[model samples]
Target: MPRFFKQPFFAWFSPSPSRLQRRQLRQAIAHIIGDQPSNLDVYQLAVRHTSAAKETKIKGFRESNERLEYLGDAVLGMVIAEYLFKKYPFKDEGFLTEIRSRIVNRESLNGISRKIGLDHLIEYDGQRGRLMPARTSMYGDALEALVGAVYLDKGFNFTRRFILKNLLSHYDLDSIISNNTNFKSRLIEWAQREGKELRFEIISENGSSQYREFIAQLLVNDEPFATGSGYSKKKAEQSAAEKAFEKLELQ
Candidate 1:
């Protein structure tokens, strides 16, 4: 079956431009991509999306990022899975899977995208009410698309090396494994040691379409110790824990 057939209905509604008309776009992309892609079509399709592209004159003439995102997602998962499996040969499948999940998850991908400055390179039209300026989801998607681009531009070897160097290398495997840590667990340990009741209750969790904000309160022995907010519940809890730890001088 054709890939287009597999795409959602909204995809076909947005018209993608002809190859000739996309020459200028390809040039713009070349500037951003830094190297001429071996396959410009893939790169162009990655940037096009129903939400981002719009047409005033023609009834339909736009691009969509959905397909690229889909392809990128598969590529990323495969590469990460292989890397983890090979790197941690002694570890069981479950251990390797967890680490891979953590490494390629939304938060981690967003962080890597920011570090490599992919956020700035993204191009989108202003037709949508307001693009999420949060930089996490967009950048994360872009990171995946970038992996797809790299795979097409160079090959699996190049893409694999890039992922390892840029994203995976930053992670301290030793520290991560030894710590096996997260804020909620750490807080629990502290509370147990201090003989205090640690509690995290959701306060206000709301946000616009671009982002979701979570507010959480930390209580120690029924006493509110700290308040924290973040894009995710876990992150919010972590922030609250840090604040509580600081207040208790347990840092």
Candidate 2:
């Protein structure tokens, strides 16, 4: 069992964790992550979704997992890159990058987070009165936040061990490497081989500046082939290219 407020910095927060909440949270963290968390508040914050974030006095903006997610994104990428480097000492940069992308992509992380039961631990605002489906990225985002929490609580080496020994160990690396998809590259290659001109043009943009959505259309031989939408121009192009690839079924 991990002791709460064990650090001097945590003591400054003036936390008062109920016995039951502390026990339950500690046990849950231990079970899910296979380690004790030094800072309970950080873990709690990590599991808190933006929808459920509350306004804080320090700043007008509410506290959410977004910052932690950003930190974890960088941390996760670095650790995974290191792991892949060591795992395949002779592999080329492109190969390593492809494998890392396959491992860290939104779809893969969402699936992995669900597999590790992070979905059940997330705290979100379900009472917002929306009948639509839940976003798949939420689980993945929480997973990243959790990684941030782990990093904060236990430092880099511990987080690395947790990721490598606990999380990455569960994945089938060989299969991931084999099934790596670079749809944009594939589309470009297909266009070159078929002697067709390929162009990806942004059709529209929406959402706030911080979180923008882009719609891209794939034009083959100056004719529209397929359209796709994503959070960025590159993502949209890749998505459009994926659709085009599927439609063309290039061998």
lDDT of 1 by residue, 1-251 (tens): 11222333223223555665466556655554455667776665565433565554667754456656777788889988888788788999978877776677676677666665555545554356465445326667877887777677778776777777766766776765664446678779977887888889989889886799998899888988899899988788888886775565452
Off by over 4 Å in 1: 1-35, 48-50, 54-62, 178-183, 186-251
lDDT of each: 0.67, 0.78
Per-model TM values vs. the true structure: 0.55, 0.69
TM-score of 1: 0.55
Q: After superposition, how far is residue 48 of candidate 2 from its true place, in Å?
A: 0.5
By TM-score, the best candidate is 2
lDDT score, candidate 1, position 197? 88
Question: Given candidate 1, what's the lDDT at residue 75?
Answer: 83
How many residue pairs clash in all the candidates, one count each? 7, 0
